[model samples]
Target chain A: MSTLLECKGLFKSYSGRPALKNVNLAIESGHIVGLLGPNGSGKTTLIKLINGLLTPTQGELYINQNPVGVESKKIVSYLPDHTYLDMNLKVRDIISYFMDFYEDFDEKKAYDMLSKLRINPGDKLNTMSKGTKEKVQLILVMSRRAKLYVLDEPIAGVDPAARDYILDIILSNYEEDATILISTHLIADIENILDQVIFLKHGEISLISSVDDIRSGQGKSVDALFREVFRC
Target chain B: MLGKYMKHEFKETGKLMIPLNLVILVFTLLGMVMLGSRLLSTPAMALIGIASLTLYILTLFAIFIVVYVYFTVRFYKTMYQSQGYLTHTLPLSTGSIVNTKVFVSLFWVTVTVVFTTLSIIALVYTAMGQEWGKMAVDSDISFLKELLFSFLLPCFSLTILGCLEQLLMIYASLAIGQLFRQYRVLASIGTFFVFYIALQILGTLTMFFTQFFSMDRLFHISENISGDSFIPFYRQLFSVSTIEVIVFCIVFYILCYWLTDKKLNLE
Candidate 1:
């Protein structure tokens, strides 16, 4: 596997306050990596840096060996932790928007996912429930034939059933050559799916290890390790 | 991609803008019929006619205010608010996005200005019944043509430029406000006020500079001997104002583009 994402001394600060310290990371293609961290651990900042939403204060980041830019954004699909979709647009209009903007977007797959969830294509986003909105966002992200998917807190606000369905969709939709980087605190629900996990604490990387090594060598699940490592 | 961005922008903003403009035209038509047709000749109906006229004026103001505010708010929300997530992540350059928003808004503003001018002309022509021309130009077609070319057309262009300048000022202010970690909206408002004050200073300085250069010639126009005097002073004034506004527009646009392209911090 080749390195699809690499960060060298990546750092970000807000208003002179550091949110991410100098850090280094590299992830291979085709792996579902869990960015495990508690609140204020800079997971979102790192994700933002990768997505080019926030400029790094100090270091370098590259995706597919390209710097973060329009070229990088073209191959990276992102789902933010908020209601970031245009609330004024209907689902079909948003689908059209995505199809117009992203070359890798699959209109048929988007519609299929919408139908599976029983969501009307004509429904406005502002009229949808929060859980339904989250599901719609996930569908939009997963429908793209992107090289990398950065999802921030994808299942944090959804119900258990919707979370499971979301995980299923993520697993079923991703291609073998693509990578998924999911940032969340609900480690147990997603532990079984992650090939690797990077634990962040207080704006710094505390640990980065494969799930198999943690399970087979330490004989403890990632969730149990997380509980023990992050116990206050 | 720029074409696509502009097409999407027009579709999104046109739905409401088209109806509002049509309503203004409809009200103008109704006003012309009421005032010019003598439809409200009765005593009580005359009072209703006055109220109708008042309503038409209010409607005009409302449309203008709504257009400017909607454009400003749309820019802020789409570029800085939560929806910015999708906007900033697009595979298009930041310059294209800025261009799409500015040019589309300028197009709509120009349309509104044209419609407003037409409505005013229609209402005045119907109400005054050839008297406006008699009073303003004494039925001299050449003078009227001169007014159109020299004054009215230049005035319209200046009006459009003024709108663009104000819009860019707001954009720059909002861009600068992104530096604040909290209360960004309030910071935007405060920055706008500061920009307004700075503009007033620029205006005052221009006035003083012109006065200082002209001495008493700024107000006193005594020389009536020459056929050619620097293409008329009014034309010169218009040219200066146009250049000033264009400069401000460029500065603000660059500030907005630089801040958005290099220093974007959508949290």
Candidate 2:
């Protein structure tokens, strides 16, 4: 499969302090890549750059060999760490909103998933718990048939059951040929499902390897390696 | 897309305005009742004073609504804050998002203006014991035109200003907010303070320029003009220059679009 996203020597800084420094990475289709990083390690910033939310201070970011812009947005589905749906909006309203804007949004698939999850179409978002809201957001993101799915901390701040459900929903809904780049600090829960792992430290890629390679060659799980590498 | 934006805008604005509208209605009703009881008073000035006071109160309410509309327009920018990540990540261009807000803000302000005008007219009729329609007919043609123009022009100008100012604020807020990742509230507050200070400085400079231009001989039309005459100055201030106002409004809208489309930072 072709590379869906390519970042070369990417650099981003906020208020003259570096958030990301010369980060290099490439993502291909048909793989779930884990973007592992601690807090303030520039995982969100890198995701924002890839999704065209933030312009890079320097270096290049490309989706399908083209620079990030409106075209990139069309192919990228982003799930932010925070809730992005208005509290006043119902589940159906948000679905319709996505449908109106995104040509590739699968309304039927979203509805099916929502119904299976017991999320009512008429339920107001404000009335739902944070975990439910996160589920609804995940449903919206997973419903898209974009080439790249950038999920930033999709399972953060949720109960164990909800986290499992979120992971299951993502696994079930992702298109087979598309790329899912999930950024999270919860290494162990997701380490099993991730096909490839990219460990980010101090705003740079410290390691990138396939899960199988890490397991067979190193004789250790990605989580254990992560703890060893990132140990204080 | 436009319809959906407007529907949400109306719903959001309704949350804040429903109570304010109720208050305005209550005060208007009270004014009518008080005016009706005092109709037989010996002093005519008392009745006129009461009528004028009622109208002034209604005007004040209208101003509040206009101001409310301004903030409502601003709220649309942040309305998606809890969800801005989703909104900015949508396939739609940023231009559409801002346009949706402008249309809805204009719609609500227009609605409020119409209601305020109707309530003020009702208060006038109730307080004066005169048929508003008949009095409107008897009122001088120029006076009526001036009145209509004054009310309508300001409402239109305010709507345009609401659109432009809020768009600028949204862009500025988004750009500045991205500087602080987790603590976005601090960034917003810091940006607001910066914007406020800049606005004050700009206002002062504009006032200075206005004063400078007024002193220029070419700027004054009447060479022998009497500064003592308040009527002519008042008439000029409320002049019904529809064409000029429309052009200015178009310019303001273009500026809003330019700022939002080119300068917005969703990060």
Candidate 3:
């Protein structure tokens, strides 16, 4: 698979403090990669950098050989940790809004997903519960046939049952060649689906290996290694 | 992409702006009906009429204020707040994003100001009845007035330029504010006041310096301080006020765009 994303010596600093330090990484197409890290390990910061939502304080980052920019953003679908949509807008309006900007956005697919979720298209986002809103956001992101999907903390703020539903939807969605980089602290729940896991610790990558390799060589599950590595 | 951005921008803002305009239209209609009819001749109706008149004036002022506040807040929310996560991720250039905002803001500001001015005129016409015609016939200024040069044209240009500058200024402040690690909203508000006060002080100093230079003052042409001084005075107006406003607009616009495009630090 081709390299879908590349970050070279990436550094992000807030004031004088570093969030991501000298991180060199590449993500290939057609895999679900788990970016496993503890809190403040810079997963969201890295995701934001990839999405062109934040500029790098130093070094280079690219999507499909192009720098983070309008061109790069075209093929990257980002689901922020927060509820990032306008709550005042109707779900239908937001779907149309997605349709308006993204050429790859599937309007029919969006509506279909909304209907299946028993979500009313005419309902304003603010009226929905947070779980419903997150589902709507997931539907919107997955409806796009983007080259790379970067979901930041997709299951962080949800109940266990909803987490399974979200995970199921994420697994079923997307094309064969598309890659997904899911950032989460929850390991055991997602390690089953992950082809590769990158363990980040304190603004640095502690490990980057295939889950199978870790299981065979390390004599432990990816979750077990994550616990041992990040056992502060 | 610019078109799509503008379309969404319009859709987002139109929800509030459209109803606000409708209220103005409905109020103007009501005002015309009440003022043009004998209803206000009754004591209670006259008292109610007075209240409605006050309300209409307040509505006119509120239109401008609401448009400014709503557009500014919308810009902040969408471009800098959590919603910014979605916005900055769009497959669109920063140029498109910022330009779309600039045009939508300009469109709303111009529309509200125009509507307010026209509504005020309509109310005045209704209030005056035949007095408008009488005044038009009696006034020397009406005939002698170069409508294009002195009154209508300049007012229209000034209104547009003024609104553009204000909108861009607020946008620039919001853009600058997002650079801070915390208290971004408070920072944005502070930035706006800093820009405002600096501009005010600079303007006063410019006036002082211009007077020091014995340049033809801004008031000279409008005040009719001298005879047949029209062309020279307007030349100075265009050179001075028009250029000054345009410079501020361009500066604020560029500051807003460049900072948003290059220096964005969305938390």
Candidate 4:
């Protein structure tokens, strides 16, 4: 498999404090990789760097061997942890906005997902419940035919059922050749869907291995290993 | 992509601006009717007329506030707030984004100015009637033309340039403020005051330099000129101010674009 993302000595700092220290990583295509870390472990910072939202203080990152720019943005569908959408816009309006900007955006797929959730396209975003808003955001992100989908805490604020639904949507969406990098602290919820997991601790990658490898070698699930490794 | 960005911006801002313009139009028309009609001349109707006049004034004030606040808030919220997540991720350069906003802001500012000017003209015409026409014709045609070319045209252009400068200044301040790890809004406000003071100092220096270097020459030329040649004098004054405004605008635009492009911290 070809590498979809590569980070070379990536480091990010804010206000004289390091958010991400020197970290090198390579993610290949066709696998779901869990970026598991506790709060402020630099998971979101890494995702933000990948999406070109935040600039790195040192080193470089690349998607498809290209630095983050318009070309890389074209292929990366990002769902931020917060609601980045305008609340005044209707669901259809937001979808059309995505369609206008992203050539890879699949409008029919987005609408179909919305319909499956019984969400009216005419409904304004501010009127929707928090879970519904998150679903809409996820639907929009998933509806893109992007090469990499960076989801930052996708199931953080939702209930267990909604989490499953979101994960299911994520699982069903995207091409098999594409990669999904899910950043979350809810390891147990997403552990089953991940093929490989990268444990990030205090701005560095603590471990990166396949779930089967961890299962056979460590005689435990990925979540159990994460708990042991990140025990407070 | 810039076109797409502009289209989205227009769609979002138009929802508020179009209705505000309509309200201004409605109030203008109502005020015209109240002032022109003879039915409101009675003592009892005087109270109604006063209320109408007050409401009209309030509406006009509201238009100014709305236009100014809308552009400021939109720039801050869309590019720096949570919405920045969506904005910065788009496959477009920071220049394109800022350009779209500046263009949209110019459009709304022009609309507001035009609306206000037309409303004032309508109100004057409604009150003064044929006297306004007489005053227009009684004025020297050549002198009026020169006044328009020198004074009014430059003033209009200066106003437009000033609007662009203000928007860019706000954008630059917001960009600078984003560097702060906390209290970004406070930082933005503080930056604005700093920029304001810098602008004032620049203004004072420009005035001092212009007067020190050219005031004597300008006065000598004015003394040699014939009847009512103040148009050239005003034009020269406005030209210098216009250049100053344009320079400030370019500097602010560069500051805003550079910071937004490189030092973006959308935390």
| Model 1: DockQ score | 0.88
lDDT of 4: 0.89
All candidates in order of DockQ, best leading: 1, 4, 3, 2
> If both were scored by DockQ, which would come out higher, candidate 1 or candidate 2?
1
Runs off by more than 4 Å, candidate 1: B40-45, B132-142, B216-231
lDDT of 3 by residue, B69-184 (tens): 99899899889989888889888889889999889889977887778778888878988869889877786774447644675678688879988999999999999999999999
* Runs with alpha carbons beyond 4 Å of true place in candidate 4: B38-55, B217-228
| Model 3 residue A116 distance off true place after TM-score fit, in angstroms | 3.3
Please report, as a residue range, the 10-residue window in candidate 1 chain B with the lowest summed lDDT. B222-231
Q: Which of the two, 1 or 3, has more DockQ?
A: 1
A116-168 per-residue lDDT for model 2 (tens digits): 99999999999998888888889998999888889999888888898888889
How close is every model to the real structure, measured as TM-score?
0.95, 0.77, 0.93, 0.95
> Of the native A-B interface contacts, what share survives in model 4?
0.89
Off by over 4 Å in 3: B38-49, B135-145, B212-227, B230-235
Runs off by more than 4 Å, candidate 2: A157-161, B1-80, B129-267
The TM-score obtained for chain B by all candidates, in the order given, is 0.91, 0.58, 0.88, 0.90
State which candidate, 3 or 4, has the greater DockQ: 4
lDDT of 2 by residue, B1-267 (tens): 556656665776677666666666676676677667775466865777667676767666676656554553355345325455665666556667667765665565555555566667777777664666678788788876765565556555655554456444544454455455567656766775776677568656655554465455423545655433433443443343333344444654565455444433455
**Model 1 per-residue lDDT tens digits across residues B1-267:** 778888999999999899989998898888888878777889999899889888888888899899989998899889988888999999989999998989998899889989988998898788877787667665567666776788888999999999999889988889988778899989999999999999999988886776576655534555542323423666777887888899999999999999999899888
Steric collisions counted per model: 0, 1, 0, 0
